[model samples]
Target: MNTSSEPGDSLEKQAGISLREARQTQLLKVFLVMSVIYTLYLAKTLFIPLVFSAFVALLLSPLVALGRKIYIPRTISAFVLIGLLIAPFSFLGVELVKPAERWMETLPKISAQITEQINEISEKFEQEQNQAEIQAEAERKQKEAEEASFFDNWFKDDEPEAKVEEVKEVKENVVTGQIKQGSIEIFLSLLASAPFLIAQMFGSVILILFLLIFGPVLFKIFIQDFPVVVDKERTVQLVGQIQKRLSNYIITISMINGLLGIATATAFYFLGVEDAILWGALVGMLNFVPYLGGLISCTILLMVGVVQYGLVSAAFLPPAVFLGINILESQFITPAVLGQSFRLNPLIIILWLAVMGWLWGVIGVLLAVPILVCIKIILEHLDVLPHWVKLLESEG
Candidate 1:
């Protein structure tokens, strides 16, 4: 009887320790996860490329599969497709360069126009203010005699000329040469990283070629062995769905921008805005980045508007037009085409663009939405995350 009680107590003690140990083990795993997450944050430069490449792969997979369906060799199809895509891009590249060339030839003219417009607007404002001031001055003179009696008595009480001397001493003091300095270090840093743009473009083109050529092989390797408890078929299905959805997204967005560019360029040309084609192309391209794009377009329009229309309403017109088109796209076209399920929350999308812009700049902003879309899809399918949570995180 004593032996039986002692044995049971010993077993209970071991089991209690095992529970505590299990808890400690789980905590250790959580700590490791947190460390890894922080490490990724710190090492984002390297990681951004991987993320970009993965999303790019997801985008291009559909086209690759289409090529396969049509019985074209992967390498040939990739080359042909890329070549076709490159034509418009190459045209755009040419357009970007054209502004620089024209600037060289017409710098003096542009400077003169900008100066003339600024002076004209300033003078107009000054004239209006002067007219109002004259009217006020006349009014003040009529009232001055009435108001001066009390002041005059007060001034006589002080000394007759004391007030005049005080008035004479109150001269305006203007500060000169108060130039705020900008950091050469930051300027040089920006200059140094300018190469990254070229590197990114080259890297992307190469990545495209590489994926197109070896995508199937790479896909197999990537998913062949996994650490998680997901099924292989499910993995492939997710990838396929992601790929199809993303590629269509890329294609659709690209087309929308292209059409918008053409429409805007035509409008600009009709409005007699200089470099209409260039501005239009920029409007189309930059608008892909969301909030910032509209801002940039508006700024450019305001500058050109001052010269073109010279009216205050004219100054507001371009931005308002941009806002209107955006409203249309957001309300009707985008929802109908991209569908509600595929859309992203505006605030999250904007924040994503800003983060990416900070990390990799404009290029990153361009990719941010796509990368977020892919991540949202993966999170949506995960059972660990609830349906409501996924819906909130998703395009919904």
Candidate 2:
């Protein structure tokens, strides 16, 4: 009786079992990750403010620490810092209203100019098409004439007097009443949401203040209570590294953007563009979102250009100059200032932007890079995922 299996068979059995276990483990991890992503997307409204507060807290942590060192109360420092941060933005918002209203008033004129430009382009295209059709018809007729037999030519009727068809132009009728009603409805809806939006903003500011004051204390408590199985010292180091990197990244990027905004505003003013400050501020804020931000800034500039210059070749100068400035800032200034350590893989950044933008819209897009950097840092510290961290590094 050969009850004992051969050594080769046992080894093969063990290898098969191990392979299946590996696959199962991988599948479970993928499932869990997807579940987490779905949960985040569903709970975005609840989480976005909290995440924003955390980031603000991280940004202000250094100031809070300095205050503590100087014997200032944490609460006082948080309040003062938050006030300083909010004041300029509020002032800028107030300054933007007049320019915004002026632009709104010019919308109808701009629309007319755009329509005329489209009509001109369409007419040029139509003329080219008509010439091509005429030439083709002539060629076909010449070929038929060459191929004609004497009897066939004699039997054909005099080409039916070369009948010309008249084309009737169709004009679309727009109902002004319907448009007005729709605009009123949209305005009412936005008005209804205004209070909610204000309340959310106020809540976020309060949350940020509280987080700034208490975040470090909470972090310390967590470190103390962490399971003995984990290396407490390493955990503390990891936390410190994340805070330092995030703070530096946010502060450096903000300063760069502010400089860019100032340059843009100065350029626009010299170019005689209206609402130069508003456009410049918009460019700075949107530039925080990477690819999409530049696109939006360029589009808005182009629209304003066309409105200002009436579709002339000169209408392109404003956006073109802004684009050049953006190229320089993104390619040269940012890398030089931030250094290689802050650079990230463009492909991964784009994918992360898409995912986050899908999940949380503009807010998601704004936070995408910071979140990606945090993930990269965590993975770098994990013994099992060094490759992932490497993949996230800039190729250059």
Candidate 1 weakest lDDT stretch, 10 residues: 172-181
- For 280-333, candidate 1 gives per-residue lDDT tens digits of 777888878766777787787676665557656766666566567666765777
Off by over 4 Å in 1: 1-49, 100-194, 222-230, 307-313, 387-396
Candidate 2 lDDT tens digits, 218-302:
8888788857627888888877888898889889999988888889999999989988999999999988987778899999899
Q: Of the candidates shown, which would achieve the greatest lDDT relative to the real structure?
A: 2
Cα lDDT, all candidates: 0.68, 0.81
Winning candidate number (TM-score): 2
